[model samples]
Target: MTARIGVVTFPGSLDDRDTQRAIRVAGAEPVALWHKDKDLKQVDAVVLCGGFSYGDYLRAGAIARFSPVMDTLIDQAKAGLPVLGICNGFQILTEAHLLPGGMLGNDHLHFICRDQKLRVENAGTAWTSDYSAGQEIHIPLKNMDGRYVADPRTLDELEAEGRVAFRYLDVNPNGSLNDIAGITNAAGNVVGLMPHPEHAVEPLIGTGRTDGLPFFTSILKKLVNA
Candidate 1:
């Protein structure tokens, strides 16, 4: 059966359509989910698309974390449902305590937008299985509070357990601790990253690079084999 992937559209979300398109391009059915809805439509996985959710009030993603959908998402995620959070969605994941750490202001104290290079550190996660360890890919990055910070022990734990799924390459765009660009939960079912993979899935579009397509494909492969 073809995988059905849900893309959640919180208020201020900018990439929900693109994410759904990417899922469809990957040979999966794209289901649109709303922030206020409790039902998931039985999607095999979920993607929290990026944007300035809730206008970034009280910190990015702070308000959206309490959305009705998140209540269900949190429970399902703990039960082994796969989730991928990108950009502002990453912030929400952290705020919801689904992922670790907090997103702080960029070290430069400015909104940044650029094509970023990242190294795949963990290829075994539900969202990254299509990548190979140490492989490098370029994706777009944009955000003001994009820096990732965590206590020393937590950082150590993430590194030691191979939970650091992606690391910035060449240059750190946001001064994230340990140059971490993304991380996965211990179960490998929840993954969050600052870079915008949904924006890079089509080669004919921005940057003409399709490096981000694997994220969708990886989940499709997992669901098919399951």
Candidate 2:
């Protein structure tokens, strides 16, 4: 059966449509989910694409975490549902406590946009199995608040548990601790990343690279085999 993946769209969401397109390209069905809706529509997986949800007025994802959609998403995610958060979505995951740590403004205090290279650190997560550990891939990243920070203990725990899913390669654009670009939960069912893989999925679009296609493909494979 084809996997049905849901893309949540909050107010001001800029990448929801692109995320849907990428999901379609991956040979899966893309289901549009609304932030105000409490239902998940039985999607096999969920992807929170980038954008300034809630206008980023209240410390990025702070306000959106309290949305009705997140109420269900948080509970379902803890129950082993696969979820991927990109950029602003990553911020929401952290704010929702589905993922650890939190995002801060760019260390430079400026919004950044770039084609970023990252190394896959953990390929066992539901969202990253299509990548190999240590494999380098480029994905477009753009955000005002992108720095990832955590306490020393949590940082050590993440490193020891192999939960640091992706690390920035070449240059650290956001001054994130240890150059972390993405991370997965201990269960590996939830992941949060600062890059925009949906933007890199189509070869004819921005960056013109299909490196991000694997993220969608990997989830499809996991769901189909489940």
lDDT of 1: 0.95
Worst 10 residues of 1 by lDDT: 198-207
Q: lDDT tens string, model 2, 1-226?
A: 7999999999989999999999999999999999999999999899998999989987889888898999999999999999999998999999998889999999999999999999999999999999999899998999999999999999999999999999999999989999999999999999999999999888898788899999999999999998
Q: Candidate 2, 19: how far from true, in Å?
A: 0.1
CA deviation > 4 Å runs, candidate 1: none
lDDT of each: 0.95, 0.94
Q: Which candidate is the best by lDDT?
A: 1
lDDT of 2 at 59: 86
Clashes of 1: 0
Error of 1 at 45 (Å): 0.5
